[model samples]
Target: MVPLLVILLTLTGAWAGRPVLLPPPHAADLVLPPDQWFTQKLDHNNPGDDRTWQQRYQVNDTFYQPGGPVFLMIGGEGPATAIWVVAGQWIEYAQQYGALCFQLEHRFYGESRPTADMSVENLQYLSSEQALADLASFSAAMTEQYALPEGTKWVAFGGSYPGTLAAWYRLKYPDMVHAAVSTSAPLLAKTDFLEYKQVVKDSIYAKSGEQCYMNVQQAFADAEQLLEHPIGWRSLTSAFQLCAAFDGTSSLDGNNLMQILADRIESVVQYNEDNRAFSGHKDANITIGSVCELMNDESMGVPIERLAALNDLIMTVHEETCVEHRYQSLIDKMTDLDFASENNDATRTWIWQTCTEFGWYQTAEGAEQPFGQHIPLSYYIQQCIDAYGPEYVWIYGGYDQSFVDAAVAATNAKYGGRDLATSRVVLVNGSIDPWHAMGVIVSSDPALPAVYINGTAHCANMYPARAEDSPELVAARQQIGDLIGQWLQED
Candidate 1:
């Protein structure tokens, strides 16, 4: 990840490079009359803001008018609904604190989809640099359009990947967005696949009912054999992807590896009737029973070899269609060993990266790169690390050893200035959340402990943030929000 070319505007004037503002380029779009409801639009831009490309935005709570401090919502992976459902919270927050709330869907999902045929060449334009630009423009436009307090601070709120983005907003556009609230953000300095790996390990070895431990162990061993023998690179890659696709999906029941393939993969995979909004569990679906039962492959499910063989074909074609077209170059390099370090484990070689083309292979002739943006996201972390200090941004792990080390190095505080805003972080884990464990605390400074929330569940907001009718939770959440306001205090 290259260091983000942060274009912070201290000028306090009309922006240059007027961005396009209107309906999306192509897609059956919907426009709702400004009302207090879930008004879904394919692509809409604020008429203000002059610094954006044909960037897209999804506006919520548009009816909340010209007075309050505006809140910009950042959605996580996939076209999520929390931005709207949580609108209830912001409604009150706005009324109480005089803040108006709204959210934008991330690239690659929903109406915010890139019009450029989803190829890497065009997708590279979708990098965080562009997103950051789009955000800045969006913020400025909103500020100008809403005519809120002359200096009403803009706040960025996100969880998971978007959580890291919020933290980044403070680091990059500190003045534009004076507040950031990041929940379960993985803002390490390096490309660590360990974060997801730990989830797999815990799901199999530590948790009950889901035999992920015994199951993955065997699959991993078999995968190792295939890697060594090279009967076909296809099976090995398939097994690896099968293991890596558990982040937002996996459940207490079984490994319906099928659904992981559906929600995430490029294929047109179908889902059972159940699909609901989740903050943490983006992949929560009706396939948990089958996914958990996948551990019993030897007894009742598809053979590991055959599953790998079949999945290799399915996921490969899926990637070719969804991921391949955009990130052709990245994908080509994905199979190579150029990026793999001797220090990195062989176990994680085939896993897909949310950060970089960690795979060492180069793309084949004529294939398109499906991944958007060439900006190594690591650069953003490094900027934070350099400016904030190694401890400023953290890589918390619950025994995801690989990820822990990678994250610490990637987002180390050694990148920039020394005036640290946040020097400690907590990697909270549900005691049973297979994503993390007690032994993996990278830095137990105690100022911020890697909290193992006992009896609480993994992806806490998956079912709770909405059901949070408890006055206790609401008051506690309010305190957190206020703290966020104070954290991004203007420099």
Candidate 2:
């Protein structure tokens, strides 16, 4: 059920059919953020795609400052809503910059859920194009129904998966949007499985400092090599997947391993903000978080367990306290480990399978990377590819993704400068982010620029380091933000 709220009136700039620009934080609406209400319901049913969707959006900005820009917030690959934990943050961004923020939830996420039978065919309708079209339609309807005030502009903003949508919106319907800000979003599709994997490895290694990383890598390698001979890698894969799941039970089997894998994935993607400042490093922000989290913590928490809905490969570092979400039926049959190197019959398979399977997975086009997730990029990229040409567009990756650099170069070279309007795709990377490439766009004409930030990880859509670094990083990020603010403030 949609949460009902009383809309705030008496906004500072709502008078005389024009906006009364409030001075930054002093704005009345901002100090007392309006209780933005939403109307969510299915808007269509595509029988061919076997899908139906509900559109949850805010329509009553009647009290909005007369001339403020209409800020539309778009979500990432998964299903999400404006009521998201981040809405207030976005509102702050808008209020700080003097714009009205309206968020749209992607399908199968949050409130914009799909009808029954959310199968592949049904999911197919959740493509980027469909999402954009939905946004366009929603805006048009809202504008007419609400009688949008004069001199209003529209801008889109998002990070990560949602960042991809923002970029796509700018490219697909340049006329509809004034400008967009995409943070830490790789324009390229999911092909960095390998690169992502490696970056996390290195980052974790670095975070632990030289000696710890060295020791751990060696241990992992030693463990990996040892398992290859005496027993099949399958046993190790199961062990890795199981240990990562932390369900620890007497019985461990293939099905249980898969379930554990699914649970791990659920928590990582559930979007835990605490992970960002947790200091203990539990954010689903990177593979290291996943691996680190799974390794550190064991029990399933309320958030990560939901990953089972997406897939069974979502392994993360278990470093937090969590609740149990599984039956643990097979946990009793599992054999225990002895640290002395006995052939871990059950856990070993999980370890071997994950190590082998994830490592073996290639890029969208089969290229390889050392550090990306075989799953996230591919799964998310499919959202765009399934709608646009499989290769009709371009994709870029960061060092954190598996073999992201190579995959990015390939995709960029293939699609870069291929066209003018849509050609000249760029893959931006953060030099410091192991999962990403050097914030450089290689796909567009002459290749896109790789914007760089020293001592920053994962392209930093929000780049917290900006506030904590040398004047150069701060200046650079400020300059970018300034450009965005300028564009936003215009027209």
Candidate 3:
């Protein structure tokens, strides 16, 4: 559920020595954003704890008419602010339906921390169950405070992990939430997410052709071999313009270094949008297709030269937040006190969620995967233990492997991850989004339909309508609107 935007910002600020960039234009400087707060228990299960924190939310009744629908835009792992109300897809729908729009920040995210510190004890309260409860509580309190019209239909909207929450909310709280729009939601939770890389490969090949894919594979292979020799490793350092020296330490091994480089490309593909500049690549061509074009440019001649060109392109995108390209910085960011502060944190909280609830580890498993070899699933597992604890059973009630398995089994079963059995829910996914591998691609029933937008990436449909949007994306948004309108009219 960790947003890649958050990951990039955290890494840049902690190790790359840069200030965290501001949110998108629509979300910036919202003129005293009308944010409201609500009180919630630290743990809904432990009612007697009396521990509570103020949860943030914003309600826009500008478009609300008597008995109009209520649109609850659920926030994901990141912060939810007034800008979401101003620019999200739901705002258009709100205007159309004369509906009240609300954006509720997720607990443990944004300014809604239940405790002063993110200690393991305090974070036990953070879970999907508690978050859904927050939505229900907020709804009740809001209705009472504003005296909302009776029998007003409620529709939930979210993208990515928040989208999963939207679907789960509709299923778990049917009476409260009438319909849901979940975009690019990874409903199925798995430990080994090999399919992620496979999708990345598919997206690259589909857009940039087979030669580009082969070039990427060759680049990683070259990196793997280059790191084996001290002289070649030194050459690699200069070729990639690494800020730090590789002292033949295991921490900055070739495989890890290559994966770090590949991650930059992955980010471009994952967040792909037409006309949007990637990572800070001002040129519109700084996208998945252009990345492939750069890598596949055979005119560059040697493998090292081709790699250098690719590295130069990535550097252009990330020049402002450039780091030494060392794995130790990653480890340091995870363990550093300053980096782990509640305000600037994303990794610790997200890693905890993956370690405990869902282990969607993005490992290099398939041959077609772009990342270099030697980066195993164990590497990420070890990271989880380092960040959280060796005692995996601490979160679960008992110390048994069967317990963890059963917990995952129960989660998937309860939420209907792969085969969601909900009505009045429209699931939307981008054809090229890496996370779609873990999402529901087929419609299980007429009441619950799914749409796949070709030539799109993560949560593209949720953004405000842009003139540069592809025809397929434009059609997909219209289809979503039609579905929502249909759901609203349902008795």
Which 10-residue span in candidate 1 carries the lowest summed lDDT? 11-20
- Cα deviation at 18, candidate 3, in Å, is 21
Model 1 lDDT tens row, 133-230 = 55675666665665545655655554444545555666676667655544334444334222333333333333334353454345434533443343
Off by over 4 Å in 2: 1-52, 58-64, 79-92, 149-152, 190-192, 201-213, 229-275, 278-429, 432-435, 438-451, 459-473, 489-491
TM-scores, all models, native as reference = 0.50, 0.54, 0.87
Full ranking by TM-score:
3, 2, 1
lDDT for each candidate structure: 0.35, 0.37, 0.67
Give the best candidate by lDDT: 3
Indicate whether candidate 1 or candidate 2 has the larger TM-score: 2
Clashes of 3: 0
Candidate 2 per-residue C-alpha lDDT over 1-491 given as tens digits, one digit per residue, 9 for 90 to 100:
21111111101111110111111121222222223434433333343543334555443242345455556655443323223322233444445454545556554443455545332233444444566666666666556665664334455555544554555555666556555554445444333334443443445554444543343333333432423343533343443533333322322232233323432322232222211332223333544345444333335322222132122333334432332323232222112222122322222222111121112222222223221122343432332323222222332221233443344454445433123244212233343353343123334343222345444443243423324445545554565555555564444
- Superposed Cα RMSD, model 2: 14.0
Name model 1 segments beyond 4 Å from true. 1-52, 62-68, 75-98, 105-124, 209-212, 219-459, 462-491
Over 1-491, each residue of candidate 3 has an lDDT whose tens digit, in order, gives 11000000000111110011112333333443588888977777776778778988777768776666667666667666566666555678778877767777788777777777666666677788888888877777777777765664567776777777778888888877778887777888777677888888999988888887888877877777777788877877787777776655574354456666777677777766642332233534568877776776778876557867767776775553343666556556665433236435566666666666666767786666866665666666666556555344475544333433465567798897778777888888988888888887777588888898998987777666777889999999899889877776676
Q: What is the lDDT of residue 192 in candidate 2?
A: 35
- The clash numbers for all candidates, in the given order, read 50, 123, 0
